[model samples]
Target: MDIAATVIAIEFRLPGPININTAPAERLQELPGIGPALAARIVAFREEHGPFDTIEDLTHVPGIGPRTLDAVRDLITVVDER
Candidate 1:
């Protein structure tokens, strides 16, 4: 299934932790507990702080944590530009 399809189709499978380096707010919102505001916060954070080097960097954002990250780990992808 497509990413969106997969995300919404299954309740047990939470959305992935989006890659701060690449995903826009819309994509980031797909994750559980990340609404538009939080998603926007993530995008804005990226704009100010720059690319994320690791998933741990998500904690720098106000709403994320290890639990949230773990919830969505399977769905998120970090693309390496270099």
Candidate 2:
């Protein structure tokens, strides 16, 4: 009798571009440079000021500078709640 081994592979994918307007800090942390603290700051900024008008507006968030924004720009998006 002979035994055979089988290997399984799994692939992971993001649902789509993260919606900055609605994504929570946990979700925001998925970005390349965003960590827990930065993610929370983003959420706080959004909550305090309102949803971002554009991806570029993320620069307004403390700790989120141009470099961080550039890293995540292609991966994030802003959606209109209204």
Q: Could you list the CA RMSD of all candidates, in the order they appear?
A: 6.6, 6.6
The TM-score measured for candidate 2 stands at 0.79
Give one digit per residue, the lDDT tens place, for model 1 in 1-82.
8998876888556444456679888888888877899889888988999877777777888888888877766666656433
Residue pairs clashing, model 1: none
In order, what lDDT does every prediction score? 0.76, 0.84
Write the residue-wise lDDT of candidate 2 on 1-82 in tens digits: 2232222221123356889989989999999999999999999999999999999999998888889988998888897433
Q: Give, for candidate 1, the lowest lDDT window spanning 10 residues.
A: 11-20
Most TM-score-accurate candidate? 2
List of clashing residue pairs for candidate 2: none
